[model samples]
Target: MVVRTFGISVLVTIASLVVAFIYGSWEAVALCAILGVLEVSLSFDNAVINATVLEKMSEFWQKMFLTVGIIIAVFGMRLLFPLVVVWVTAGLNPVQAFDLALNPPAEGSGQESYEQILTDAHPQIAAFGGMFLFMLFLNFILAERETKWLSWFEKPLATIGKLDQLAVIIAGLSLTLVAEFLADDQHRATIMIAGVLGMITYIAVDGLGSLFHTEQLEEDHERDVASRAAGGPSTLVKATGKAAFFLFLYLEVLDASFSFDGVIGAFAITADPIIIALGLGFIGAMFVRSITVYLVRQGTLSDYRYLEHGAHWAIGALSVILFISIEYHINEIITGLVGVAFIGAAFLSSVVANRREERSDGDSTPKSGGGESPSEMATATD
Candidate 1:
């Protein structure tokens, strides 16, 4: 199962490394490998969140996610998105932006390097991505659920969530505060606008998807009841057509939001666009896709009930880090480790809970009346 899932990612990693070596020798290879690992580690929580969405999609859409989705994630987000950011922020044409990326301005020169332009634009970028992810975390924690990993914390939040649009109000206030204090005077308006747009984008995409999904559920329930009345087999219904398309679109946007930090952080390691694409887009993204599918197929989220909660908490931490990074540069290692710590702790807690449940079930079982239970008899004979 592991090979079936990660085989393509491994092959792509090798290919990307080989290309990196050919492009700039062993140094490029090392940088590419490091960036690939960095992206995977940083985006581990992204995979978990993605699995929760992807499992709702039909098989055809899931296949599209592996194929068409990867293309968009690699070229669109990792490569073209950065170029577009440079073009927009730096006021350069497409060709000029590409050239600037390839031949970055030297340090101490009057002109800024490609990385500098992107970094300078970080306030707006961080505002957009951070707000979008913050909404996701807010909605997750605020919504009531049957299973609670952090019950003491989540229960209060769920009660607070009963207020309509509470997530939006909090997110808006948070964005305003960040733009007012954390952002520079020149970038403040832009940050505010970008953050508002991010919130709108999430609302539109998630809202439309939920609307269609609820309709689908209602239709499915009707069909199920009719089928039962007619004494016919009741078929399962999965999201497809418009419903699945919106879900797919939502997933892509989520991926874009997650990629903002990783793409910007990669520049700290190297300013080469080609190398970054090879490492982050080709290798890192493919592996994330594989991990998402693996989790869905293995039912890992169901087995380890707290894993999704952990991922969302990690996302909340990341959103805060993104805001902090706008004013002060936080190490990518710190960002990645924070996510890993949340996921690891949740996983261990889940293991302990599972064992405790097993022991409770064992103790609660009724004993045979005629004699000692089989297990007790065996122990007595021993």
Candidate 2:
């Protein structure tokens, strides 16, 4: 299953290496490889979070994630999304933007390259992505869940989540604080507008999912259907198509928020759009998708119960970092490591929990096979 899941990633990595080697030197190849690894490490938490949601989706929708979804991640976010950003932010035609990207201006030129222009547009991007991700984390933390990893923090938040629109209010306040940090009126306005749009996108996507909620059949009918499916008569569980569509949209947006850092950081390594797309887009995104599938198929979350909690916490951290980055330059490596640390700690905790459970189960089990204890047998006879 691991081989099958990573098959595309393996192929893409080899292809990226070969292309990099042919295009320049071994140094280029190494850089591409590093970028791919960087992307994976940075977004591992995103993969785990994605799996938690994807597990709720139908198999058809799951398949769509790999097929249609990968295309959007690769082309839409990696390739065309940047072009769109340049076109919109710089007020240039798409063709001109594309050319500028492919052939950026020299360092000595007074005019900035497409990469620099995009970097200059970072405030707006960060606002939009940050707000969206902030709300995502807020909603998760605030909402009531049967399970929790950090009870001290989560318990209070869940209680606070009961207040209507608390998440939105907090997000708005966060934007206000960010606005205060910025000196430029225009940049502040841009950030405010983009952040508002991000919040709206979340509300719209979430509301759309609720609006498309399908009524389930009666319990008797569900039981019969489940029995038939389990008995190998019926084949599949039907999923609500409209709900799936909204979920898919949510996944795409979430993915974009995660990709903003990767896309921008790619310029730090190389300004070549093609290489970024091939390494980060193709190889990195494919591996993320595969990781999501693996988690769902293996029921990893159930086994590692706190993993979801940790991923959300990592997301919250990332969101804060994104917002903070607008005013200060934070290293991409730091951001990635923060996520890694949160998820890694959660994984270690889960391992400890599993071992504890095993010990408890072993202690409770009967020593002899198919036999009652002497005490039990004597009591029964009495």
lDDT value for model 1: 0.94
Instruction: Give the TM-score (vs. native) of candidate 2.
Output: 0.90
For each candidate in turn, give its C-alpha RMSD to the true structure in angstroms.
3.0, 3.6
- Error of model 2, residue 179, in angstroms: 1.2
**Per-residue lDDT of candidate 2, residues 74-107 (tens digit):** 9999999899999998898889998998887888
User: Considering every candidate listed, which one attains the maximal TM-score?
Assistant: 1
Each candidate: what lDDT?
0.94, 0.87
What range of 10 consecutive residues in model 2 has the weakest lDDT sum?
Answer: 212-221
Report the C-alpha lDDT of model 1 over 1-382, residue by residue, as the tens digit.
9999999999999999999999999999999999999999999999999999999999999999989999999999999999999999889987898899899777778998888899999989999999999999999999999999999999999999999999999999999889888888898899899999989999999999999988988888899999999999987888888889999999999999999999999999998999999999999999999999999999999999999999999999999998887788899999999999999999999999999999999999888766888798768779
TM-scores for all candidates: the values are: 0.96, 0.90
